[model samples]
Target: MSTEPDDIVARITEIVAAELGVPAEGLAPETDLRGIEGADSVRLLRVVAKVEQVWDVELDDADVFGVSSVADLSAVVASALQVKA
Candidate 1:
């Protein structure tokens, strides 16, 4: 898989959209994830779970909590991918 940020953002956007029951096109890297209609902590965690499953990378609690948007999540994912690589 490509480790580029845009690719990571695209993948994260898809995961967030599915997990939050939102349209993929409506999501963007800068979108406030918590502002999403059903994006409570549990649902966000679920999104993180799906991301980890898809990318085969484990994210730390600090990293997870530090994310407020799809872009931040993409950064975390990219960092994890780098470490894994």
Candidate 2:
């Protein structure tokens, strides 16, 4: 898989949308995850879990906690993938 930043962001956007039961088209990299209509702690955690599964990388708890937007999550994922590589 391509570990390109743009590709990661696009994948993360889709994951976030699916986890939150929102339309993928409604989500952007800059979209605030917590501001989504159905975003709760549990659902957000599920998003994180899904991200980990898709990328085959474990994110730092600190990094996961600090993510506020899709782009932020993508950054964390990119970092994790880098460390894995």
Candidate 3:
């Protein structure tokens, strides 16, 4: 897959870190989001909401739910940004 914009990835990582109570530095592209400590559907959705707010873009539920890791989420965000642009 192609790389996403650095700014988009950075902001997405920041939102995930803030909402999930995980340090941004601890998250990696292959990190399993659902496997993260204290992570649940609710918390994950909160992260998604925060991302939407931060980027002023909406994400599809299918795409959000289908994402299993940080990199997948970043890809979804990048696609959304491309559509918006």
Candidate 4:
């Protein structure tokens, strides 16, 4: 996996955009997932699933539930990568 933050964020943004059908350009690291139109648990789970797939890391349900934005999830991903490393 790339260690660069921009690369990680870009890939994550793409994954989120594809899963949520939101415009990638409109999403920021702080954008609230729950506030997005049409966002639901199932769809949000799919986003988590996709992130796991991309990083090959399994996230805890508690961590997943507490995340409110991409930046939070990205931080979890970073921690997972550190542990995996």
For model 1, residues 7-62, the per-residue Cα lDDT tens digits are 98998999899999999999878999999998899999999999999889999999
Ranking by lDDT: 1, 2, 4, 3
Weakest 10 consecutive residues, lDDT, candidate 4? 1-10
Best-to-worst order by TM-score is 2, 1, 4, 3
TM values, all candidates: 0.94, 0.96, 0.86, 0.93
Model 4 residue runs over 4 Å out of place are none
Writing each residue's lDDT as its tens digit, candidate 3 over 1-85 gives: 2235766667667777888898999987778989988899999999888878777789999999999987788889888878988
Better of 1 and 2 by TM-score: 2
Which candidate model has the greater TM-score, 1 or 4?
A: 1
List the global CA lDDT of all models.
0.92, 0.92, 0.82, 0.86
Model 1: residue 8 alpha-carbon error in angstroms: 0.9
Worst 10 residues of 3 by lDDT: 1-10
* Clashing residue pairs, backbone N/CA/C < 3 A, model 1: none
The superposed Cα distance between candidate 2 and the true structure at residue 20, in angstroms, equals 0.5
For all candidates, the clash counts are: 0, 0, 0, 0
Estimate the TM-score for candidate 1.
0.94
The C-alpha RMSD of each candidate to the native structure, in angstroms, is 0.9, 0.8, 3.4, 1.1
